[model samples]
Target: MNPVAIRDSYDVAIIGAGPAGLAAATLCAKGGLSTVLFDEQASVGGQIFRAIEETPVTDKRVLGASYWRGMDLTRAFRSSGAQYVPEATVWSLTPEREIGVSLHGGSVLTAARRVVICTGALERPFPIPGWTLPGVMSAGAAQILLKSAGLLPAGRTVLAGCGPLLWLIAWQYLNAGAQLSAILDTTPAGNRARALPHLLPFLFSGYFRDGMKLLRAVKREAPVIADITSLRAIGDDRVTHVEYRRGNGAAQRLAVDNLFLHQGVAPNVNLPMAVGIKHRWSDEQLCWVPVLDAYGNASIDGIAIAGDGAGIAGAEAAEWRGRLAAMAAARALGRSVPDPEETHVRDELARCLRGRPFLDALYRPARIFRQPSGDTVVCRCEETTASQIIDAIALGCPGPNQMKVFLRCGMGPCQGRLCGLTVTELIAEHRGLSPQEVGYYRLRPPVKPITVGELAALPKTDAALYAVTRM
Candidate 1:
């Protein structure tokens, strides 16, 4: 995990140290390929298993046995012969397999015969009134704080929005003795009715027991306000109160210092899309997913995407997809790989994904939550509001790229990671088109913000060279 000793070239370069990236690296290394695994985190566990190796939470039961499962994966990744470089911020991947990365205040250019991007998932954009408030943060953020630093909300905390992660965090906070004010569930009642038919399929699938157990645990500990509406955080300098109306009830306000929001996650597509990979809108997940083959191969020949970055299929599926992608990459690189084991893994992956359609239908966020109305801030980085986006659309802005030109929705410090989905959905809704028809922002390097000093510090030997090929 040394940044200084990293080579400038490899047979395969995997971007990210999440479950998928780790699994892919392990397989490639086992095949005797010169592989390098890069990640921005100091450790290999992705968000799903963050801080598993070095968490202060001694009792693994506090976080559940599923959370502890990542330890086994990380331990295997460490023993793999692939060169693991932690704290490496990879900004771009060229079609020709050049990777631009920054680490330790310096830049490096690396090349590979095959590049696997497993950047994982980001919390789906959940824009609402007062979402930009100081105390307002994502539920995933709260979990990361808990995992990395054993930090909990100081005062009364309110969990808002929907998804299993919300329930998991609520249970974790309860276990950690944090004072949780309430749980505001935004999942519409109709979602459950629509998802009823798929329930039987899920019962026999992989996630049924665990999913039911998580729900029961949260329901036992927290007071859940279902079918919530008019959710708005109220405060001056910070979040002091959270207001919401349940079902047809009048607006109710609760004194809360922390508001943790969750509405599920979307694939982290900035890296793959930057390389001109074709993507399709997923109706089930209601987000953009890269158009990848069975083994996670992108439209481009030399690059492959795995994990939640390709699609949201959870950690176990990501590991399988990663191994499959590595096998594909190894074959492409003229290495012999086992076909039977790959077939078995693919079957297991399909089984893991059997319940996803049900989960997606059952947990789809409300329309208002997905695409907010009025003056709600849609783009946090630029402080762009939904009203501004509408104004742009009215002015003949056909897509998100033009909205970016007219309103700067995706041009900020965090790039488009924070607001891209909301912007896309907003424009699509206004234009009477699907999100894919409206199209997403055409990303460019450097994907992660980099300083000129870092660019100057790059080794002078490796120069930029990429052959342009249309896919």
Candidate 2:
């Protein structure tokens, strides 16, 4: 095998350029390891720290101080001589730690090394009638459109969801010259009271200060309605009106041109599952998170998961986990990790775990999954109806993987990010099994599509090595 023909190998391949990946790459490079950071986006700073080009950082308040911290971190990574590959989507991961990545101009590059998956989470879709309409989109999608692309939905938009992201979207939409009809937050106010005792100690003045800033931003622009029971988007071609059942059981309808809905996020674990990593259910977050230790080591050696890919801890927590994971990987590779620094990292991680009350209280999954409307679209890929999934379950489809074969729910361009959670719930309900038992459908490489020419161009020796590892 010609050495030049083989793709590059790194001491550490960080699979996402988001907060976690960026943090890990920065630390690993600084720690004297050859690091390469890969991201599907054109720039670093995953979803939480979305990248904006040439925009003056004048509106510091809107961007928040944490956002600026992430910016500084990216700068440090760039200066540390880490290879940053943007607009590169990693399609799959082999058990031997080789990553299949689709790059610009349809070229595929393989990076083989100790792997860290920081491939964050996707928004949980709340499917209702007219959800697939033109103007209806996930809350995170709306934020991305506004922040990344500087575009808004067609007209007046109603933001509906249960997370802090809803408030952020409302603030962004209002600032972007888009009219806001209302903000329907489904999170119950009582949740705060219930979780208050656990959160009180962590309620430093800074927490309240940030909350007040967000509250002041959206207070006058939109009405914040709490305890929303149900939502229905009604329109023939685009969103025209939104009907919601209030906490008081009174049905209310608002005339709106667009509707943005979200129900928090779940780990984008397809790549990890494809690599056969273990996972477990998170009852508090209501999703399946990859099984990782305190240092983000998965069951598989040389494979570490950090950030929302391990679980949906926010940016700060992700950064800590990323650093910890990198240190653990370094130690596994026969490098010495400073004992004092490792202890400090573990303590910081503990603090982050302690500060997660607001996130958990604000982002619980909606109870609406208990009774999915028969007509609502459960699988957006093949346009599989909820009824079809129900019937498939009735016909003895065992789980999501089998259901995908039967009904093609998760087999699409978006790869079930839009509909996987709902399908899992429906299958679990029908089979009388827990949602965790249904599990996410297994993901295969190429996680994303690759041209045949790219595959054929792979060095025969490398391909043979990959084949041997598979056996």
Candidate 3:
């Protein structure tokens, strides 16, 4: 994918091309703001709507009704007159609204009057023994292949972990006529009981009916093992078998060519955190999330976070959040958004989020899964094991930052994106403190790795020249 021509500045800059970013760009551009949208992917839609334009999944049933919704969003965004830059990385975003984007191996420095980060969410790390094995991957990864490339695993595959995504993936694979060996459901038996209080609202929401349909479809085609208290992938170089234990029962192993794991997703917070957005550990979601107002404005002025990056309210809510944030940005830029329009977006967003608490409760990952033990590898990038993290804590490491000093747990190239939550949870458990008290990694920019050549190749302005030479 070739890069689009970039301007020196824009009225609004969106850092993702998912539902939120797309919706925000459409609104901003339609409102007469000179808007620019940057997405690292070759296309938009983040994960949920990935490959909305390019996917080869001709049968809508394969990807489902929810996915086809992105077609309308893409159509709106393309016609809205916003500059859409595909294969672009907005790696460094400053609090003052400067954006450093890399395209075709070079960096472009641009600015915006107001910035909306819609980087969306990442699959919460599912670290287990042998997860680092070659054939093992995330369920999200598998779905990406099905969506983007119309590809599926060649042999028997096992889908493990708990979350709506797990079932969705299983159903997708089934609908696509792919082979499914089994599904290892690790949802604790008590989760349903815990989720019951929130049930009434969940049943009334739009998701309930659709979710039940997907659930029934998946269960009918796939063999499901429930209450899987433990899981492991077995192989020397690549996962050849999936071993799991149900309840307190003896372990069982199934030969499988692919092992896809998921425990839901958390906000993709690296860029926002690097930009100094205030964040807190979400107790319900079990991950770090940005602190934002109702309009998605963050702690810093001129910066707002929408979509799952604000919190995981799913894709429809993300689109609404994007509109809300765009409206806030437009207002901040001295543009007027009609009161009724703002109220409608706000109301839609509320309706979308009404069932979120229930979903969060029902799908909350178990503590044992969140905090691994012994030989389980916690940080895949650093090869930092759960035992290693535990030893650091036992040796008086107070938190993730200090543990980094002791074991280099979060300093790998991926920078704690994979291990940050795990390390925080491990430390919290050891110290008998909450994740909030334990805290997250102190992040910095450029959030994504950039080449020295890329930085030096940056169009050398007065400030750029000054920074390279003290004289």
Candidate 3, residues 1-471, lDDT tens digits: the string is 234678989999998999999999999988889999999998888889999898999899899889999999999999999998888988899989999998978888899999999999999998888999999999999999999999998988889999999999899999989978899998989998889999888887789999998999888889998999999999998889988899999988999899999999999889999999999988999988999998999999999999999989899999999999998888888886564387788788878988998999989988888899999999888899999999989989999999889988989889898989999999999999999999998899888889988887777768867887965
RMSD of 3: 1.5
Off by over 4 Å in 3: 1-3, 338-340, 460-468
Best by TM-score: 3
lDDT of each: 0.88, 0.77, 0.91
RMSD of 2: 3.6
lDDT of 2 by residue, 17-112 (tens): 888898888888777777788889987788887774333433665555756677777787778777888887788788888777767645545665
The C-alpha TM-scores of every prediction are 0.96, 0.90, 0.97
lDDT of 1 by residue, 1-471 (tens): 233776768999999888899889989988888999999999778888888888988777678877888888888888978898888999878889889888877788889999999999999988989998999999999999998888989988899999878988988888787777799999998999999988877787778998888888788888888989669988888989999998889999999989999999999988898898999999789889999998899999889999999999888899999999999989988895564397799888988888888888899989889888788998888999988888889989998888888988889988888888888888889889988788888898889999988776665543332222222
lDDT of 1: 0.88
Sort the predicted structures by TM-score, highest score first.
3, 1, 2
Q: What TM-score does prediction 2 earn?
A: 0.90
Against the correct fold, how does model 3 do in TM-score?
A: 0.97
TM-score of candidate 1 versus the correct structure, residues matched by position: 0.96
